[model samples]
Target: MPRETLFTKIVAREIPADIVYEDDLCLAFRDIAPQAPTHVLVVPKEPVESIDSLTADHQELAGHMMLVCKKVAAAEGLSAGYRVVINNGKDGGQSVDHLHFHVLGGKSLKWPPG
Candidate 1:
């Protein structure tokens, strides 16, 4: 219905990504314009614009994303701690239209997040 986002390109392998994790449910890869030392994006294979577009059928999908984030974060040696962020819309600072979660760690993260 709309033009594909950069993330969509990654999903289709039209663009290269430093993929950290992937499964039938979703895909996880390093952010090109990384905000933190350890910045990764976990995105669902089935396109959803944002969390606002999530429906009842997406509940399990959402949970799976979190579990994957957790496993990947630990694997990345961010066992100390990490932040999982979802920027839902333009005002929420979502640069990409695809629904994805940012996992940031490897340094102290100050709150009142920017």
Candidate 2:
């Protein structure tokens, strides 16, 4: 388990989220602001500040996040292709402190990603 984080509140059902997939370790939900036709935010139940904070001990959790992203994407009919993104620090465009992977697809995405 991790220290208190916004994601912890969301996972604890303290805040509402349009959840798509969920297990003991993570949760996938629709993004409030969709960058693509299909956009979902996959977050770990544990409190990881950002990708930069992941340590060797978090390898399994990292792998699990990828696996869940694939599963969620497939379930959402994104077999053709999809983009998985993890924004790092402020320079990387991280808004929330909680670590999350954005799964985007359901349409052709352009380069640069804006």
Candidate 3:
């Protein structure tokens, strides 16, 4: 079945994206709408809808995404610090339907990110 999300389209190569990293299980791409100097989206190839839907089977993928986030941050020279975010629902400011982890860094990030 077709994945019901923009991220799915990106993963399926149906949409153009500046990909930074890719593996058998996931892909990391630059966020078209960047919030920081080094903003990237790390996502799994699976059709997970959101973080809330993650299960035991997704544990390894989730960990892989975190490792990828760290690797990307280091590559982007964000050694000081960084933020990893996953917007859960509409109220959480998630516009995309697929599960994704946002890696934000390369500058002093403010507290209480909006």
Candidate 4:
């Protein structure tokens, strides 16, 4: 089995986080360092390394994460628009080992994101 990750620690309540949303399946929390006016992470409770690790059975989990992202965006007053980013691997800029969705809004995010 894989070792625990930062996100797993948070989910286990071993570390504190600025959690914004929580349900039976996942949780949404504010980013430690804000990238935009509003930046939060929508994460699944079940730690699956990254999107590359998901199987057919995990499809519902992925969809659920997206729905939670929308819910979090609205809750954060990002009615104008928002961006959901999933950094898959090293080349995709995934700093964390766990799969997570970045919900960013409250500003004009440029195209061709870094």
Candidate 5:
């Protein structure tokens, strides 16, 4: 079983979030600490621990998440461009255990982000 993280709570409606989008497979909400003018976190409703926990069976879920990110970006009016980032672990700057994609845009983002 996957460990329940803060994201899981949000998905379960046990915690409140500035939700931007939601579907049967996933949910998207605004990040509490915005990195850019627009920062959103797209996560699967089914907890998956982290990127390291992904398996071949998750192939379709992974692709679907990316599509959700794109949809969110467009809804946010990020026609200029946007960045989709998934941090895997502690060293990778993953503060949360649940796998999630960060959609950041609305401003010029610096390259080689730490």
Candidate 6:
């Protein structure tokens, strides 16, 4: 079985989070440390370790995550624009082991983010 992760706790409602959107497939919430005015983490209910852990069966789930990002961004009033980021591994800046999408917007984002 996959190891439990912080995101799994959030999904199970064991850990409190400022949730912004939720559905049967995924859930989205505010980031503890906001990198932008509108920064949210969209995570799947399934505990996939990271992007590196995705399989063919997760294709629909992955696509659903992107759609969740669009919906969350629009709901957050990021009409100007938004950025969807997925950190693949430790070097890619993925803190939580679960796969998630970071929806960032509310201002002009610079290119070549660190």
Query: What are the Cα lDDT values of the candidates?
Result: 0.93, 0.92, 0.90, 0.92, 0.96, 0.95
Error of 3 at 76 (Å): 1.2
Ranking by lDDT: 5, 6, 1, 2, 4, 3
Per-residue error for 44 in candidate 5, Å, reads 0.3
- Model with the higher lDDT, candidate 5 or 6: 5
Per-residue lDDT of model 2, residues 1-114, tens digit only: 556766788899998989999999999999988999999999998889889899999999999999999999999999889999999989899988899999999998888876
Top model number, lDDT: 5
Query: Which should have the higher lDDT, number 1 or number 5?
Result: 5
lDDT of 1 by residue, 63-89 (tens): 999999998899899988999999988
Model 5, 25: alpha-carbon shift in Å? 0.4
| Global lDDT of model 3 | 0.90
Which lDDT tens digits does candidate 4 get at residues 11-37?
A: 998999999999988988889988999
In model 4, the runs with Cα more than 4 Å from the true position are none
* Candidate 1 lDDT: 0.93
- Pairing residues by index, what is the TM-score of model 4? 0.97
Better of 1 and 2 by lDDT: 1
| TM-score attained by model 6 | 0.98
Residue-level lDDT of model 6, residues 4-80, one tens digit each, is: 99999999999999999999999999999999999999999999999989999999999999999999999999999
Candidate 5 per-residue lDDT over residues 1-114, each given as its tens digit: 877789999999999999999999999999999999999999999899888999999999999999999999999999999999999899999999899999999999999998
In angstroms, how far off is 15's CA in candidate 6?
0.6
Q: Give the range of the ten consecutive residues with the poorest summed lDDT in model 5.
A: 1-10
Root-mean-square deviation per candidate: 0.9, 1.6, 1.3, 0.8, 0.6, 0.6
State model 5's lDDT: 0.96
